[model samples]
Target: MAEDDRSFVDHYAVLGLPSSEEGTKISLEEIKKAYRNQSRIRHPDKRPNDPNATADFQFLTTSFEVLSNETTRSCFDAKLRTRRERVLRDSFQNAKRRKMATDLEQRERSVAVDPSQEVRRKEKMKADELKREIAEFKARRMKKAFEPLNRKDNVEGEKKDSSLDKGRMLKAIWETSAGDYSAAKLRGIFETFGIVEDVVIRTNSLKKKSSAIIVMASKGATVRAIQSMSGDTTNPLLVLPLESIAPSFSSTSSTNQNESMGPEFNNVVGAGFQNYEAFVMKKLQEAYEKNKCM
Candidate 1:
């Protein structure tokens, strides 16, 4: 291996096979199985444009090639064994030094000192306690001064945070015929607008279809997402604010949410959603009238 690649290229570790310590005896079948599993996880297409992904995938392939064939396998196994032995030897030496250093420190601390030294140590300890008390006093005063400001900000922050609470959450519905509304896909679509806190996919057994509820970080995020994702009828996907959906579907609880979300969740941005829609519609109408005059 080259100097640059040496740090990262561990063939056995990458292949998820037994190390030299485990008496490396991986079968050809095991190697092939491990490669397929790891390749799926590290494939370039799955992680597009990743700077290190291509190199890592190539390294994985190289490891498989070297370890599978008899001639290369012998050479590689010999090098791996030597590397493991060197690592184990270094570890043992490090542990021994650490134990010796700890023993010395304990011995020095346990030994009695002269009277003058003891007096100086007691005085230093007293001084440190006084300094610590003074620091604590100052901290308390600063905290008291900032209390009102923090409380006020927290009230506003809490209102928004509670909406995205695990239980009784506020979310938007995405009704799509795409048949592949994965959480990752939805996150990718909406993340550019704002933070997506969670995505919930529920099967509608009656309709034999699937829809998703997206929980955004804030009302502004929800508005931005709706504007971008559901701006026109020409778009196949129908993005509606949770407040607009029928209560049965929109206000339904997630099976995963066991924790109690307080009554404050009722205040989540329903009115804001309506206002956002009105604003978008007004803009569209204005554009339409202007084009008619033209």
Candidate 2:
């Protein structure tokens, strides 16, 4: 049979099969199975302009020529058997060949390690470590990004995070270094945003300072800010994108809100954003066009 006409072919050398391995004694059924798999992988049509692939395809063609014929298979089997049976008894030749291959591999690995690669890897590691130390920045950005994700418009309408039967809300507490200015400065910070309904920062019994259970005007907005910061603690400077503060929800029917007006109730709190007047108008326009409100 011509090389191209064969369904598949794999030289034992190409497939990493030991030199001793031969197709003569193996069942024809096994060869066909292997051929189907290797043919699809090494087919020239499958690999575009790959020199190794072209060579491999050629070798496979030669392999098929030998394996598919009973007479040719007999010859290959005899040669392979002879080589393996002698390799164990003739240790000197076998050891020398193995040593040469091992030395070549070691030299290749040495060349693979360019000094530039080590420099880049260390630089990346340092940047990541710096970010992890500045945990406060990551938290703030995470809070901002996540706050706006809340589905303010529950399917029924005007649903808040605590209200939804399913869905979660962002709950990130502000972080400040331990100092006289920390608690006061943190309070002033939250006060400036006019978003925090309640914030309690204190030195714990362990003498460690922490902020707990802070409420936000828009939990969704806070979360949006934070997620935008980044999950990779590599760069402290890459704050979350400010534009992510806007909630992504389109509209919701107030009727869908929990009738009980529980934690899910939309509290008419002031957002206190600097561009409040402009922002409110934009939201009003969006709500009007959607025809969500009566």
Candidate 3:
């Protein structure tokens, strides 16, 4: 089958990203990485002894081979319109086939078919097909995009928590998305944060905070990374400061700041690495000034 003729991944869909609104150009490494993802899923060895699986494998392999080349992905995008369209085309076709089979069963049963119903059914079926295709296209793109996290346990099981290895101590936290780590991007995410010494996520879990820790690579870099990702979903910054973590999570609001400002909870009043370090520092300095004056 032709790659575009119901037999290839849409290039945009494969990348797990939307086509660039700003005319962003595709890069070689991005294409290569996407192909690598398709390879893992569509490789024949991973498939069972099913004819459909084999076809899927071949199709996926072809997609990778073709799209990985700079020229091919550009051509494919024009043909597919949006990445979603390419992803959904095959799935839509498959659903059409199933509906045809069911229609055959209905005919055999001599089900009463109103002419208007048939017309409406035709229109509705078309609309539903489009929706299904779009949804599946999204799913396919996300699947490929996050293929890293959703792989077999061998990959995820490698989540490193405590590495006495190489004298690298760790206090890292593995922070997957809300559900299972359905993608293998955790290690990179942590490294992006501060290069904790180690990182790990459970094989069949989706709890954020995987408990990977690495020492910060550079104070400047780590700080910048943290500042940039304040509202990050995987690692939400403190809505309240770290110094406020104890009180923020513990109490609703600090109505009596004077009464609660005790030395024992100095740690609790410190800003976390995630939010407002400057403000925390300023507050500490202000308190020192007041104490000196007294």
TM-score: which candidate is best? 1
- Model 1 is weakest, by summed lDDT over 10 consecutive residues, at 255-264
Poorest lDDT segment (10 consecutive residues) of candidate 3:
238-247
Q: What are the per-residue Cα lDDT tens digits for candidate 2 across 136-220? A: 7889888998786546445436545446322122222222343343445544544443454544444465544343434445745
In candidate 3, what are the lDDT values of residues 164-229, reduced to their tens digit? 242232232333453343224544654655555434433425533444333444444434443444
On TM-score, the stronger of 1 and 3 is 1
Candidate 1 or 2, higher lDDT? Answer: 1
Question: Candidate 2 lDDT (Cα, whole model)?
Answer: 0.51
Ordered from best to worst TM-score, the candidate numbers read: 1, 2, 3
TM-score of 2: 0.26
After TM-score superposition, the amount by which residue 75's alpha carbon in candidate 2 deviates from its true location, in angstroms, is 0.6
Instruction: List, residue by residue over 1-294, the lDDT tens digit for candidate 1.
Output: 356346745677888887675625778788888999999989888789798889889989998897788888778778777776877898999999999999998767765444467678999999999999999999999989877666778899889976554322234444445456778987887788788788887766567446678878776776666665554545445565564322222233432111122232222233343444455556666776899899
Displacement of the residue 189 alpha carbon in candidate 1, Å: 99
Task: Give the winner by lDDT.
Answer: 1
Worst 10 residues of 2 by lDDT: 235-244
